[model samples]
Target chain A: MSPGPARGPRALTRLRSEGSSPEAIDQLLREQRVPLVEGPICTFLWRGDADGVAVDHRMPEIPIPLPLRRLKGTDLWYASVELPRGARIQYRILVRRGESTESMNDPLNPRVVGEPIGSQSVLEADGYLTPDWAYPDPTVVSGELVDLRLPSRALRRDAQVTLYIPSRMRRDRRMPLLVVHDGGDFLQYSSMATVLDNLMYRRLMADCVVAFTHPGDRLREYGASAAHSRFLTGELVPHIEGSLRLRGDPRGRVLMGASFGGVAALSAAVRAPGFYGALLLESPSLRFTEATPSGTFGDVFEPVVRFVNSVRAHPKKVTDRIFLTYGAFEPLAVPDRAMAEVLERMCDELRVMEALDGHNWINWRDRLLDGLGWLFPGEARLIYPG
Target chain B: MRQVTLLGPLDGVDLAAEIAAFGVDGPVALVTAGWEEGERNDAEVDRRLGGGSRNLNLYGRRLDILESDPGYADAERLLRTQIDELRELYLLRLRHALAGLEVIRRRFAEAQRRPGSELDAAIDAVRMLDETHTSSIAAAYEHFYAQNPPHERPAITRHREEVAAIVAGCAAIAIAGGHVGVLNDCLHLGHLAALIEERPLLAWSSGCVAVSERIVVIDDDDPAGRPDEIYDIGIGVARGMVALPAATSRLHAHDPDRLAVLARRCAPSVCVLLDPGDRLELRSGRLADLTSVGVVAEDGQVLRGAQAA
Candidate 1:
C-alpha cells in the first residue's frame, strides 16, 4: 500500500543451483513454469546455445540489463536474481547467438505484456495475480470496433482512431465517451477491448463510446502539446459529438492516459477546464520541482515538469472525478501521490489505489476496473424475471 | 398470512400471470414509488396487466401528501441525516470486521489442508458483523419512529389512512423495483408494510429489498473487489432472505468462494439469486424453492431445491 516495492522473506527452498545438466534443466522447466519466482529469488531460463544472454528489464530502482551465464557443459543458460516480493517487471530475454543476435520473448514463459514498442515477457513476483475480469467472456454479446480516421486540421494530418461501440448501444442510449492517449499500446497490451466487454457484461461499468487514439511522436506530442489539445477538443470531440449519440455533457466524457500520455490528458483538462468530467490517470509522470522525483527519468519529462509545476502553483478545478492508480514499485508512485493530494482537494471525488507491482502495461491493465467503475457506474438493468 | 412471491425484474410482464395464479379477479394495488419522479407512468403496467388488473397507486398519493406537509419533511430530513452519519461509522466497522475475516481466509488459503468447520466458523463471524451492522440501522429507524410515528401524526395520519383505505380495497399488491431507497422511504411514509399484511404480494428487484428485514446492496459482479454496502434495514414483510435480482448478469454465481461469502454473511437468512425468469416464494419465514433456484451455501457452494437454508 505504500509508495515503494515490498521486500519479502527468502524462500527456504534455496532454489539457485550450479552445474545443471541440459536434461535436468528441461525436466525442471517441464515440472514448473518458466521464470520460476521463489520468494526473494527469481530464476530465469533460456535454452538456446548463445554467445551471450542477458535480461532487458526495468526494475529494482535501477535500469540495467541482467546477464545470464550458460551452465557448465550444458546448453541451458540461467540467471537467478533477488527480486522483492510483488515486483512485476517486464523484460525481453536477449539471445546473442554469435554474430546474428536479437532480443527475444521467453519461449517457455506464457505470461507476456505488450506495448507500442513491442511485447515483453513478464516476470510477476509474489502477490501479483492476473485479474479475472481482463479476460474476454464468450457469454456476453460482443461490441464492435470500427477503424476510423479523423482529419485533424490542428495537426494537419489524418489521425487513426479505433472506436468501440457497446453491443447494447442504440440511438436512445447516450453513453460516456472515453478518449485514450497512446491508445494503440493500451489496446495491444492492456487487453482494453476484453476488459471493457467484460465490465459491461457484468454491469460493473456503463458501456461507453471509446475512441482509442495513438500518437505519432508520443513523447513530443503528448508532452502537454497545445496542438494535441486542439485536435481533441476542437476537431476530434466535435466530430464524435455530431456523429454519435453521446451523453453530450462534461460529466459524460472521460480522458485517460499513462505517463507522458497522462501529462497530455491533464494538460488537456487544464487548458479546457471542466471539458472532461473524469480523468483516469495511471502511473502518471507528474514530475515537478516541488514534487517527489523518485528518479530523473529522462529529458522527455521537461515539458511535463513545467506543466505540473504550473498546475501546482495555480491549482484550478479541472475534472470532477479522478481515478488514479500506480505501482508501488514504480518511480512515479511519489509523484502520483502528490498529484492525487492536489486532485483530492480540487476534484469532487478522487480514488487512489496501488498494487505491489512495478510500472508496466499489465499493472495499468489491472487497474481499468477500479478507474472506469468509479467514474461511470452502470445502473442495474431492470429485467423482470417471469 | 398470504404467501409472498419474490420475483426478479418484471421485464416480461409476469405480474398479471403471477396475480392470476392466485385466482384473484379483483384489482392489484401497484406500488411504483421506486420509480421516484416517474411513479405516475403506469401505461406500461396497464398494457402488461391488461384490462383485468386495475392499478391503485398508493405511493403517488403519499408523495403528494408528504411533500405538502412541512412537519413530515423536516422529520424526514433529520432522519436521513442521522442515518447518513450512522452509515459512515458502520462502513468503518464493517471494513475492520471484513479485514479480520480476510486473515482467516488467507490462513486457510495458505494452509496445506483446510478443515470445513473452521471455515464455517469464519463465515459465521462475517454473518455476525452483517447482522450487527443491520441491527444498528434498524435501531436508528426505530428511534426515529418512536419520536415521530407517521401513523400517529395528524399531518401524516389523514393521508396514510387514505392510502391504507385504497390498499384495503385491492385484492393483491405488486411492488416494482426502481430506486430502492425511494421505494423504502415511501413504503415507510405510507405504512404500507403493515397495511398490506396478509395480502398476496408480488415484488421484484428493489421491491424485494424493501420487504427484506436487512437491506444490503450486493455486487457479485466483482467477486474479488469491494464488499457489500450495508443499506438501511427493509420492511419486515419478506424477512428470511436477501433477494439478489439480475443475478445472472451481476453475480459470479459459479464462483464458490464468492457464493459462500454472500450466503454466509446473511446466514440462517438464505441468499437467493433472482435471475431473469427465476422466482422464489416464502411462506411462514421459509423459502419455498419451487423452481429449483440456486441459493448460496455457507460452505462455498451454490445449493438448489431443498438443500437451501
Candidate 2:
C-alpha cells in the first residue's frame, strides 16, 4: 500500500535459541501454514533441501537471491521478511545442490497464482482481500466474449481481438470502447470478463465494449513498434468503429496495457498524439539509459528507452487523461515514478496508484476497477456516485 | 405555522391513525414517485395511511413532461451533467477525507492521551468540506431554477398545476421512499417541497433524506468500499435538520468517532434518527416535539430531549 522499507515482528526469532527441539519446529510447520503470516511477518520454511536454499521472488528487484537461513541443529530453513499490510507476493524456492540450482514452488504452501508459463507460490499477508467485484455472481448478468479477427496491412498479420459485450447488449446503444493489449493473458490470468460482469451488475461502473488484442510477437511488437501502433490506429480502429455501435472518435476510446503492453500504448499515443483520449498503463517498462537497451529484458528495450527518454526530455500534452499504476516492490517503480511525474504535467487529468506488490497479473487485475471506471463512467455512476 | 410530522418507514404498521392525528380528515395525496414504475402499488401505502388515498403519479407525470417539452428536457439534461461533474469531485474528496477520519480515531486509541487539538481540527476540516459541498450543490439547483423556472414553461406548468390541484383537495400529503435520487427528482418536478408548506407532510426512509435540508446518503458496506457521501440538496422543507430514517439498524451508533463526525458535519442541522415507533414534529425550522426519537450531540453521543438552541 506504500513505498517504504517494511519492518514488522520476526515470528521465529524466539526459536533461534538452542533450547528449540525438532518436534516443536515440526509442529510450527504442520500446525501453522508455511510462509506463516503473523501481522506483516511472513516466515517462509523449507524442510528437504540440499546444500543451500533461497526465496526466489519478483519483489525488491535489487535483491536478486534472497537466501533462507538453516535453523541451527535442524534441517528446517526459515526466512522472514516484513511486508506491508495486505500485500500479496508470488515467489519460487531456489534450492542449490552443490553447484547446480533448480527453481520450484514452495511445497509447504498450497496457494498458487497462475502465469502464462507456469504458476508462482502465493504469499498473502493480513489485509489482502479478494476484491468483491471479481467473483462470478449469479445475480450479475455476465457478458459474452466473442472472437474477432482483423487483417493488419502494416503488421502483415491477422490480429485476434476478443470482444466483451454486456449480456443482452443491443446494437443501438453507443457505448465506450476499451482496447486492451495482451488481452488474452488478462482474460486467462485475471478473470477480466467476470470482473466486468460484476462491475456492471453492481453499478460500480458503466456497461461498455472491451476489445482484447493478442500480439504475435509480444516482445518485438509491443516494444514501441510503429507497425503495431499503425495496425491499431489505422487498421483495427477503423474496422471496430465502422461495425460496432460506439461513441464517435477518440473521446470514448481508451488504450490499456501491462508491462510491454503499456510501452506500446504510450508509444502509439506519443507517435499519434491525442489519438487516444485516455491511457491506462500498469508497471510499464519505462527504464531509460544513455547508452542503449541492453538489460535483463533484452536489447528489445531500445525503442522503449528512446520513447521514455524523449518523454522525460520534452514533456508535452499527449492525451486528455492518463492512469498509471506500479508496485512499490518492482524495479520498474523508479522509472514509473519519473514517467508519472512527467505525465501529470502532460495530461488534463492524471491518476497514479502505488501498492505493496510486485510486477504481477493480480496487481494489474485489482487496479482495473478504479482506472477503467474513472475513464468511461456509466449513467449509473451519478445514481451511486460513491 | 403549526408543524409537520415525520416518522420511520411504514412497513408492517399503517399510518392512518397518524394522518388522522395530524388533523387530516379528507383523502390523503400519496407521492410514491420514489418507487419509479411501482408508483401504482398504492394499496399497501393506502392501508398504512388508514383510509382514502390518491396516488399522485408524479414519476409518470415527470416522464410525460420530459416527452412533451424538448427544450425543458434539453436544459434539464445539461444541468444534470453539471451536477454529475460536481458529484464526481465531491465523492472523490469525501472518500479521502473519510479515510483520514479513521486515522484520527486510531490515533486517539493508540495514544490514549486526552484527545489532541490538532487531530480535532482535522475532523473539523472534513465537516467543513461536507458543508461546503452541500452549499455548492444547493446553489446549482438555485441556478437551474433561475434559468429555467418550471412554473413558467408550458409543459412543466401544466403538470405542476395538475399535481397542485390534487394536493389542494387533499387534507395532507404522504411520501413513501424507494430510490432517493428518483424520488428527489420527481419531487422537484412536481414542486412538492413548496406545495407541502400549507399541508402537513409525512415521509419516511429515503423520503426523509429527500425532504431534509441536505441529502446525506449513509451506505453501510464491509471494509467501507467508498465512504458515505453527501448526495445532493434535498427539498429543505424540514430546515436545519438531517433526517436518518431507520438509522438505528443501519448506523453504528455506538462508535463515538463516527457519531461525532456525523453530528458536527451537518452542524446547526440536528441529526435526528427516526426509527420504528419514533415520531417527530418540525416547527419554525426546529424540533418542536418528539416520541422515542434519538438525536446526535456535538460531542458524539446519541441523546434524547433535543431542543433547538
User: Chain A vs. true chain A, TM-score per candidate?
Assistant: 0.81, 0.91
RMSD of each: 11.3, 6.6
Writing each residue's lDDT as its tens digit, candidate 1 over B1-309 gives 576888777657456788877676677778887875567777787556644344445556555665677676567666665665576456556666677767777787888567457766766766776777677777877888888776667857887777777777778888888767667777877787777686888888788888887766766554224467657777778877877777666665566766667777776787777766668887854566545466777776767666653
Q: Give per-residue CA lDDT, model 1, range A205-231, as digits (tens).
A: 877989999788888889998999889
Residue B246, candidate 1: alpha-carbon lDDT: 72
lDDT of 2 by residue, B149-262 (tens): 877889888888888999989988888877677788889888888788888877776777788878776644322144556778788888778887767666754676788878
TM-score of each: 0.61, 0.74
Worst 10 residues of 2 chain A by lDDT: A377-386
Ten contiguous residues with the weakest lDDT in model 2 chain B: B219-228
Compute the DockQ of candidate 2.
0.10
Q: Using lDDT, give the best candidate's number.
A: 2
